[model samples]
Target chain A: MARKILRGIPVSAGISIGKAYFVNRQKERRIPRETIPHHLVAIETQRLRNAVEEVRQGFMDARARVPEELKEHGAIIDSHLMICQDPKLVESAAKNIEERAITAEWALERSINAIGKAFSAIDDPYIRERMQDVRVVGDKIMQALIGTPKPVDLPAGRRVLMAHDLTPADAIELELSKIMSFATAEGGKTSHTGILARSLQIPAIVGVEDLEDSIRDGDLVIIDALKGLIFIDPSEDELAHYGDRKYQFEDYQKAIVKQCHLPAETVDGYRLEVCANIELAEELVQVKDNGGEGVGLYRTEYAFFNKSNMPDEEKLYEEYATLAEQLAPQKVILRTLDVGADKLLDEQAMLDEANPALGLRGIRFCLRYQNVFRMQLRAMLRASVHGNVAIMFPMISGLKELRQARFVLNSVKSELDAEGVAYNPDIPVGIMIELPSAVMIADTLAREVDFFSIGTNDLIQYSLGIDRTNKHVSYLYQPLHPAIVRSIKFVIDAAHKEGIEASVCGEVASDPYCVPILMGMRVDGISIAPQAIPGIKRVIRQIDMEECIELLGDVLTHATVSRINTKVRKRIFKRFPEELSFFASLIEQDDITEP
Target chain B: MEPSGENNSLEVVVCVENELGLHARPAGKVAQLAQSFQADIALCVADQRADAKSILDILSLAAPQGTEICIKASGCDASEALEQIGQLFHDKFEGDT
Candidate 1:
């Protein structure tokens, strides 16, 4: 007889056989109330102080041990250390022990809890996550005061980390090679731990509330991280099935990579430009590795985020220069400072509002913070001297924003000249036509800006007033909405009429089903996520522009979602009948296609 | 500026300093805030008033730095809401603050 194990949701898509490493807990014990020797109180106080210092040093050393890529989060850990060393927390604990005659452990817990309550009162989620950091440092301090070290064991061999929840420190300390996967009982989509896990490419399953209690040590487990599914101890047949599935997935990923260097053309010989959207300079390697034509959009906001203060012009210059150098000749369109509702700059920006998605953000934010925006613009201008760097402004609603953004660019260029910094004077400036207003005035904006990019993500969100982030209303966030299609079509036409290149760098552009519509609209180019490049190209090659235009004509008149979906599906099925049959056969035979 | 509000509307004036005045993000914020109340809200610039609840309408105004704009709100909570909205402009909507 074989035993089975049950656990949390698996976030990454893969199967692996590995050992289990149970997370260790720090020993917590209450000090006896009877231990109050008045003379010893001073010694105990001094001992606690020393212990706090030791823990603080431990945290600092731990931060230093983190990889350079992850060192950006050092400020978060430092903030946590301050929470531990907060005079208010220390004084209250000491007062409680001396006056109420409470145990040191109890006194510490109460004091930390009080501080945590204060943090909880903050309306911002970013600030709220900081509270957890405070708790982590406080817990370590308490452990140190009690003379207990939180034990962490790095298990040998490929092992999955099984825990209730992982702190940011826990994630940073993880040895990449030994870890096969990770599953936790608590965490959300935006947790730093989860983000780190994805960045490390480690399979992870989070938010499995009862996983800690259900699995025993040494139990066999299968984690399918991509589908968020977890399988406990499996039958031999099940194990073998997953083993094959794992190999197939790896092979598929390799196949996608192999296709990277190949031109994104269909069997019929239609070529389409497939570019990558990069967040950091390091990600340029993946773009190059994948044979991306060029970077369609370089999100500059990431440089400002995950830090205490704004990055200065020189700091930003270095970052942009490196990226521009790497992707030289191939253009990099840098979208300046898209921070707003979804990404806040500071605590005060995260004000309580009826709707945050519709709040001040993107170019609007950059405009408000001109000094910061100008620094970014200056950095971008300087980087342009290194390579073909183009500038783009996000969330342009009309001609005014576009004109104003262009005006700032001119000023930055002139300032760079006065300072004798080498810069590109003719760097093409673009606007992201993401709002209906921008779409309506696309002709005017296209004339002013050098190029136009249709940001379908926000275009659809604004056109429908449906918050894509909100799960309940996300279903209504349809990209193929008649109004959205018209808006995109309008921008594309407007850009073409003004002789400006137009491309789309939205999730919709990557969608295979929507490629035909994009082609029909006569977009100059389509920029998609790196992963979706091959499939989108395959779709593009199979269909002719004339046929796509015909399909669009039929699609534009459909009133309901189902009607539009059916029409598009029918058009796609007609164009790629063979591919559809192949897919159906593959699905029938294997029950899954890795791609 | 002439009153851009409808009948029985409250008038509140504010100055624009956000470089890309009343553009996407800020316009979206204003729209989101304006939609919260039962009253209809509108923003005025250079004798033009656009619905505050409509991002397209607000953005078209193209209000720039040092531009004086009037906010008008009508219906329930219009007076209080107009004052609150006026303070957002006075505070520059927390931009660079």
Candidate 2:
């Protein structure tokens, strides 16, 4: 048996076996707290200044290396650079060394603790989070003072990188070539570290409890990121098993990519459009490469974030125009400015609502800020003339909200007409059937819109009243729940009745076990992350429509989520055992007591 | 022995005009510019006072957008310090947009 096995939330999927290397640990180091002689005070103060200068230079170098497209990372590094030279930190530590006659490391630790105390009393959670920046900067200075190796100074050869947490700066500074896989003590599914790992196509796990204490530097480890497990000091048998699993996963990956471009048609000749959901224009290459038919959901919020002012209409026009031009023949559905809740814009963060998820967001935020909304609409309308562009409004709870949004779009169109500017007058406008309220009134909404895109991620959350990111209640985030399954089915059926197309976008669309059931419901299309396209498409091509309808019948009859999950899992696992081994499913057997 | 036009102490009220308030980037700019002047400068938000030359101190103030801050400076270049620093708030700390 392995010495120990640790579990965490897997963000990126893959496997690797290598020696562990810690970039930084959460545990406190044994600092030399002894008081220095009065004669040594001047020397200690100079040492502190030199350490700060060294760390400041490192941040400067990292900032310079940051690509133009990743300006967000550069901004974060700028903040760290400021924090490194902040007088409250460096100057106070210098005073601590001079007055208390302590070592530079000890003085710096004292300064950090003092800043942490002040930060703890802050009411705004966003401001409070800035304390982490101070700590990261402080740690770098301490490392310099202690003569510890920086992350860039990793020992020769590839290794599994570990850290308490990876800041944007740390993620940028690390040399990717020397790292095989990485795990962190902090982060979630949407964390930046996970995004980095996925883009890098390496295995990664985050929020790993006990990741630091369980493994030492240079210990041989197996990172089973596919299942979010770490085997420390694995036995010979375990190594052989993982070695085989890794080979199979890579083979499966290649096989899926080779056949990704094929139409998503079942054995019985049933077809469904598979598209990519993307946030940035830069990801358009990934979309085409992954064989996505078009952009299903082009999240427009990226342009609005990390800016001092909202992006102007002309700037937005250029971005959307470029996207529409590049994907000229292919359709792109642009979902307008969905801010608040988890993805807070600067202005919205100040609202500091008691319940932001239910608060002003999506179309509601857009409606409230007409200037911002009007600018986006004008941009989208102008870009529509460039290529196949469809506009989408998110979080439409009812007819009144939908009508209000349409009113604004109509006004924008009229203004364009009066100005004699060119735009697609008959551009398809759609609403995301994300709210349970929207699902209930889908038939009513279908008459007014071009299509229906069911956002199951939010539908499940609002319907179940559970936040999946919240660990204590995440077990209750059952996507296959009877209410959820019924909600999706009802919306699709409603769209069909009104002679419109309905597509599913979210994790449900990507899951192999769930896609078949959606196919049975006859969802017109699906939009998933670009990377998940090939595997999901392969699953679609391999199955028969007859089997999908049968599985849906079985799933619907089972009243409980666990029963539905069990039945679906067994059937899907039997038919696609090889494919199932490589894919992670939303339907887990967590509540099932028997086979 | 002071020049007639020169002032030893100055105070000016400035509102945070940037959408993100006085976050790290803005705070860093304030500190960097303040360090260049020889004035003993401080920013007063509500009852709290933060050193204008310390990013940590300014961040701890946690002043969001639209909050009024008083820039206080006392030195040979105090008037020059207030005018230039207050201008940063007006311009949203340059290159922000």
Candidate 3:
């Protein structure tokens, strides 16, 4: 019999065959804000408190079922419960309800909204995510007082969870063992739920449009995570074919792991460095596991963000030092505070602008707040004492910013000297060639800095005049645009001409299909997310640099993005037909099998 | 706690015993205490924070383990906060041992 198939957003890395289990999106009901009678306020408050208690019991039960590894997160829920029961929140809601003669639900909702809005306004994603914790607390209180349905547990048995979005709390509460895979109707690959799925190594797909109504529970499903394909209700022949392919894919992944320690060299003998772009210190494990040469780009902003206050120098130093030590001998290139108009430092630092991407951010913010900049510089410098730590400044427009940054570095050195603390005075400094102006003056900046790392994500965005963060303009943010490629080539050539090392540490570097083009550009290194390292290296090892260089030379002359992309893809397929054929064969084999 | 010294120029150097040192939680506590004092309080760790009043300045000190820090406050309330801050060090800043 012919089988039916469904498509979904691909999030995680592997394929799984499971029964369809729909994770119903919890409906959010907005409570009225009007006040209620005084006597009823006391009654409603008691009712809300009782409801919160019930939800707390449910949370405890959920925690009991979670694996021992995830018990610490349970503490976070406990703290959230505390916030729900906080005398401050309770009393304020009670007072508001009594004075305004509002329903207990309305008063509680208003109080929670105030707290959630306040948390959301903070400049940290970690802390901002805590706003959801506040919502969970309110949801519990509302459920208790207003009789809202309790959050249901994940469906039992092997299945692929389909949902609109899964919060961190929601993800933590899921029975992971029973979940074969997950597909979210909405969410980017960097969302907390996405990260959690990746960490759990579950097959997941995100950003699928209208995925909820298309599939129903108990439907047979096939998820091809590697290719970002989902098949629902397939023929028996297709299922058997995919089952064999899934087994082969698992073997291939194992082979990559075994080859992790091997050099990333093309068939003809050109070697390349495959490094990882690490966001959190804990992610360092993945880098090492993947046999990354070192941290190509350590995003340090995550450490300082999502906090109640600025991370003091010592705290920053310790975190940096730990990463440096862990990657000892291997270099850790730290990109300094990249916050800009999009990410405000505090409410006081807010500059409401029509466009934030072009506004003051990156090194510009550092220059304006010399003290804050100095603290980061000092921390980075201090951390250098532990291992090979290099510093890179972001968003340089011209020579003035680089010179001023150097001046600050010198002043920090003098301070460290006077204080009798040992620091590496000769620590290498680099600049991110993201801005068009930076690329234009790359030769000059290369002369001033120790190295250059092209942030293709921003380079493509700025070169194309597209704001990557803006959903409306996201469609235009193509990395293969010849103009963007030329801009990258210009900076790479400039850095080389000045005898400075250069590398690409953006989303483009992580793409397997783009590895040949990057190699042809003759960039010194490629830094990508840890998970992409092995696959990227595998692609890198299959092609000759000379052929890649020839392909790049031909593609560079193309005028349009589609033309450039077509030429690149054609050259890649022509040069590595075997690899392309393998991938195609895997696509043809449509069965899901357990690894 | 009050400083025993009669001289307003008295200064004491102490080591931060807390695992996080004088990070946000401790720094905020110190800043709050400093606000109460009428003295021109300056915290010096290493060569930084020499002309302090800036929380950012004190933080840049990056004083870690085995590091010595000096707390100097010069007015009437200076002695009180300084004494309390010094005692905090002696008390190990309520740190886990």
Candidate 4:
């Protein structure tokens, strides 16, 4: 009989069935603080140096293997190289070895902590995030010193990689064609390993504890990343079933890839617009390939975060213009730098924010410094001339902030007009209905803006008083809560009442359970990660508007979140049994790790 | 302020005006400049001090925007070293004016 399926948090989406290849990194954990004999110190130090060279050489090899299009990621490899070659790290390791008589792995840990102590007093969240980068560097070096094999070079056969944990540096340089998927016992969905797997379209599952103990080498593993489940040693019937399903999935995916160029309408002829939310310009190709009709959310802060110098209007214009021209006729909603909180800025006001989520951030931060805001507005305006573009403001609490933003946008527009810049003078302006206050007064605010796009992530956070970054309170950040559905209903109803479109650009928009409910809500559009386009569209095309509306009605009538959640899941899964089954692992995943 | 003549050293304090503060990339630049000068250089944030030329040490300072850091140097190039590091902050470590 097949062993009971192991459930884990799904980090990336896909399906793979292959022989298991286990990579044990347990030694790094087992001897975190080991002591060395005094005489062995020299040998340990030499070992550390050799490990550094080996890791450094690995980076050099990885860099050489990286394709030209992915050269932007070469900067990450370079950062790792800098950490490996850093003299302080090397010297500190040597010092710890000679003085404390510790193992190289133990020495590296102590050295990292000793360095981390200096950053303890610093208040900048952005700088604080760098502490993790240092930790990653330390771990990478230790992995090298331990001579852990990455299994990067897999033979041309179906293979499933099982690791205790995998880093970006280990995963990025592989010739990924041979490897079918990845399952790890550790890492979050947004970890570099998970993100890289998604970008490469590789099937990946993380947080699968004790995978090495149960799953042996050469075991046939079925990785259903969509549902975040991996089936081990399946029966012959299951294999045959999966074999047919895999074939259909690939053919369906290929068909959907071609459908990007087609209109995102339902089989019943219900035309619902689907767009892409992009972090960088390189993703434009992915967006296009995924059949995105337009750019929904252009995260401008990424451009600001990556550079040392303040991103001037010209630089912003060039970047925005490139995106606009590429997706001409398709609208690009450029959100002005939504910095603060996790994202840091060079400005004092942003730094001074004690609670960035509720402080001088988003639209509030923009209004604080109109000159900086003006430059961004000017750049956005300039880019609009190149193609169809729209402006959206983040974290709009009330009409006052929205009006204030429009006033500044108008001023920038006037300045452009005087300068004889040709732009879409009547470019559509929108507001992200993310705040609870905005949801309450959506009727009032909807009358003022061109459109309303619901940002469910922050909306839920503020509504439930959940600090998503705080893991303890994260369970409270429920997307299917009765409150969220009602809020979404309010905003969409208000937008419809005002004769404007309402769109969902949050994580929930792409969720299978949320999709039918959103479609039932009669949302004009949904914007999601490019990779999710096909799967979501497949769900959208399968259901009728009447059933969706009925499902929404059933869900909203319930008082508790769990009640509504169960109802929505049952209704949607009934319509998409195969599709939801594909993503079933994540559904069975007891609790969402995301805040 | 003029250089202190005590042991031919110089001590000066300057606030980081850069919006991103002195992060890793800019810290790298500062560390490189510190290595070029022939002086006993150190940067102090509050009571903590980091060897000016070590990138890891400088980054550990975690000097956010508007953090006033103290630089102390004693050598023939004390004043010169202080001025250059101070100027990097003043210019926001933005390569071009």
- Highest lDDT among the candidates is held by which one? 2
lDDT (C-alpha, whole model) for all candidates? 0.69, 0.86, 0.72, 0.78
Which residue ranges in model 4 land beyond 4 Å of their true spot?
A1-8, A15-224, A227-252, A258-260, A348-353, A584-588, A591-595, B1-97
Candidate scoring better on lDDT of 3 and 4:
4
- Using DockQ as the yardstick, the better of models 3 and 4 is 4
Whole-model lDDT, candidate 1?
0.69
> TM-score of each model's B chain?
0.82, 0.90, 0.74, 0.87
Clashing pairs in 4: A227-A583, A227-A585, A227-A586, A260-A291, A345-B19, A346-B19, A346-B20, A347-B19
lDDT of 1 by residue, A1-595 (tens): 1254443333333456665555643222323223355655665666667767898788778777878788767645655554555555676677766665555665676777786776566454544555565568667877777665333446567887777677655654556677888888775433345545644557777776557556645667777665454566766876787788778766765665676677766455556677887676766766776678889988886767645577888999999888888888888999998865455667326565565566677887777778888999999999999988999999887677777888888888888889898888888888888888888888888778889989887787788887654434544767677888888898889888999889998767866667778888878787755555654666675567777788899889999766787777676877766434322110021122332
Model 2: per-residue Cα lDDT over A286-319, one tens digit each? 8888889899999898787645577899999999
Q: Native-contact recovery for every candidate?
A: 0.00, 0.67, 0.00, 0.48
lDDT of 3 by residue, A159-193 (tens): 78877677655665567788988887766433445
Which residues of candidate 1, in runs, are more than 4 Å off?
Answer: A1-228, A232-237, A266-269, A347-354, A566-595, B1-97
The deviation in Å at residue A18 for candidate 4 is: 9.7
* Highest-scoring model, DockQ: 2
Query: What local lDDT score does residue B53 receive in model 3, on the 0 to 100 scale?
Result: 39
Q: Which residue pairs show collisions in model 2?
A: none
What CA RMSD would candidate 2 show?
15.2
> Can you write out model 4's per-residue Cα lDDT over B58-96, one digit (the tens) per residue?
877777778999998877788899999988888888652
